[model samples]
Target: MSQSTAAGDAVQAMMRAVVVTRPGGLGALEIKEVPVPVRERGWVRIRVKAFGVNESEVTTRKGESDPEVTYPRVPGIEGVGVVDEADEDSGLRPGQQVATMMGGMGRTYDGAYAQYVSVPAAQVIPFETGLPWDVVGALPEMFQTAYGSLTTGLDLRAGQTLLIRGGTSTVGLSAATLAKDLGATVLSTTRSPDRTGELRDAGVDHPLTDNGTVADQVRELMPDGVDAALELVGCSVLADTLRTVRRHGTVCFTGALAGQWSINDFTPFMIPVGVRLTSYAGEAADLPADVFARQLEAVAEGRLRVPVAKVHHGLEQVQDAQDDVESGTAPGKHVVVLDD
Candidate 1:
């Protein structure tokens, strides 16, 4: 049978959807019944089991995403679930477990905050694992971003000293765990001194509080500066973070939680000779399937960790989830689970 014909053989008509009607706070989100997405020739429909509540989604809800983000759209860039519909030739089939993330999802296109989501077939990552929905749901986007940034962006080595400037964030903790596994000495940071223990338990060898002189504190510890630094706080502190790296150290900017976007006054001379500065904004296709599968294997084998700071029951609780993520008090990421 043809691909489209095969997809037409099994599908549902309508499903529940959570929509952001406008750029507002939590009140703007609407949850109601909506038409089920039709599977295009090379697209796959996922029966979303659970999705992570990302800070990006929170920013989008507050009317602060990229200028091109459209209203009345779903605001989830990551999710995990079963394939409900797929063209036969799409290399996917009903009953398969998969994940979808990045690539205009929850930004310019309908996202995973719904009962169903249709995405390009190539973006549907297939995997086999016995992990529960909630645990696996939190992996796709955050872990892939962490893995890619560590391996591809920084080219991290086994014996280097690495610093995560925003270590308490979900992705930051993931990097700490992975870096520890790679035999790197990991130093992490949080704005609050109380959370230093939390970072230690998460495998951070050192946890420094950010008090405007964080670079000085790091220098006190390393003396020669770190081998690499992952900048998550953004341009406001980019220059300071750059100074905390060694002569030939690598610095990769992966996030902007500090409200500074552009480095308008930047100059190449600002960087020390032999230092390298790079940034990573992982796209949907940026997380490779092979790398993701290896991580999943590690998770299943009890070597890797997925630390969910909080869990909300269903779509109705997504507002609470986002509220917590915005509060920035959670030691880990918040997740919204759909009861199976």
Candidate 2:
């Protein structure tokens, strides 16, 4: 249930959150009552309505502790909620709906897995009309990453050929939809033939399997070779992706699902043919705000569909949601819906 900031002064505040005491699996996450967040200057307390889960969050949670996280942390990267409190000095007001991507939440900072969270005013953004719970919830991590890859990491342009390796993933589909909207030809890959129709509906011109022949398939589609590649499949095919690019073409490798790859040498026999290889780490500020707004508009207009792979109720269900996301049962995105 939504709460009002006006009541902040009168009551003892406590909220529920999903916390991971130690990173292992879903069993490590537990629901507990925590203090309601209070806004600091230039920050606002968000009454988190929904939070989107991603694979990166899962990996970080289970991996060895690094400098970014200590034990007993909340794990949520992106969130959508109403503004509970705002700095009067700033233009923000209470009750404005907003969203934020994974700058620090759920990693180095407290995140939206709780009923309430405090984030910088600049990080919080107001939403226009028609922003749905599912869509807004889904935007933070995947959309921002896609925005980063296409705009910042790779200077994707109209009429270029893009090979998206993970066609059905949240980030992968976002890239495909974004490229198609920008007037580019998007060729994606899926592990299942059953996903072909869905990929087509999502605007992918061609879909292939990860059978080590994606390069051959891509060559058949474009004799000139792909202009760029969004490599979600990982480093195992780095050479293959490079081969698919035209002479002097670019390859933006984002994620590594294929396994560990160490590039000891950048110059190989391919140098004679001319291919550019670069590693991409999501979006930077290079992606314009108007571009992100356009994607949001598409979601609002039904052009972008944020399918709920699975919905788990209550903070206790956070682990189940994580499991579902990892298991890949849900089609698009996995969301955790807190009970009012």
Candidate 3:
């Protein structure tokens, strides 16, 4: 409508989308024809090519997400696609490759679970890559969280020792790959002994089994404790994770993979004396354009991996993809690709 080259004028007004009528089990997800979202002044409409199925969406479907999530909503926090429409001043042209995530998406408003999504211009990240749609879709939220946690949350540096508490998760695997590339020694944990090999293949230096607690094993590997630790298992194991860090080392909490959000009795003593505690819940801008482009190039050139566990073909497989993610049957990112 704003004279963008890729405006959707020739496309139909109605498109198929997976809608959650209300918070419930997998049965709550239903495929229905919904009007394509209209482009607003400060927003761009994306013809979604692919999107990753994340645990947060699973929580949204179960009605366990933050109070911001409402019924009959589309559930997707991250997507990669071409712009269908944009205002002339938005710096985004129609058909420009882009990615969007985490500015109240899928919760406060409808999100990428549809054929098209309208998102604020500020939250959209533009990039150029030759990677496939499924691979690119898996990168946005997973890579953003991992990159932000390492650089912003931990200030991780080369030659340092880093520990991932929930090593088998998509973010955990992403962090391990990035940390390894940064020349850090990675010690990652997994509850399943079978998945330790997966961590090793992801360039992890040490793969520790997580039987609820991993501090003892971590200390055994690094007598002085790791230089930094990433807490993805959540508050339930935050105290033990703190013990895995050396004096003055940092621990950054970024995910709640164990589904535990808060500790009943939190206290200052729960943290080590000289260790710093931080958390990362960042937006799209936290992952700079240069960083995103470089990572995409790395993946394209085979210097890095996307760690995609599976790729579902269309909206019909959305439930199956969510089920695989919720069940943890796969240890990496699950993506849904919408083919024309």
Off by over 4 Å in 1: 1-12
- Kindly report which residue stretches of model 2 are placed more than 4 angstroms away from their true locations once superposed: 1-12, 64-67, 259-273, 282-289
Report how far residue 129 has shifted in candidate 3, in Å: 1.2
Q: Which of 1 and 3 is ahead in lDDT?
A: 3
| Clashing pairs for predicted structure model 3, backbone only | none
| lDDT by residue for model 1 (266-287), tens | 8989887888999888765777
Index of the highest-TM-score prediction: 3
lDDT digits (tens) for residues 5-54 of candidate 3: 37555653788899999999998889999988878899999999999999
Cα deviation at 85, candidate 3, in Å, is 1.1
Worst lDDT run of 10 residues, candidate 1, spans: 1-10
Task: Report how far residue 69 has shifted in candidate 3, in Å.
Answer: 0.7
The candidates, ranked best first by lDDT, are 3, 1, 2
Enumerate residue pairs that collide in model 1.
none
Give the Å error, residue 31, model 2: 0.2
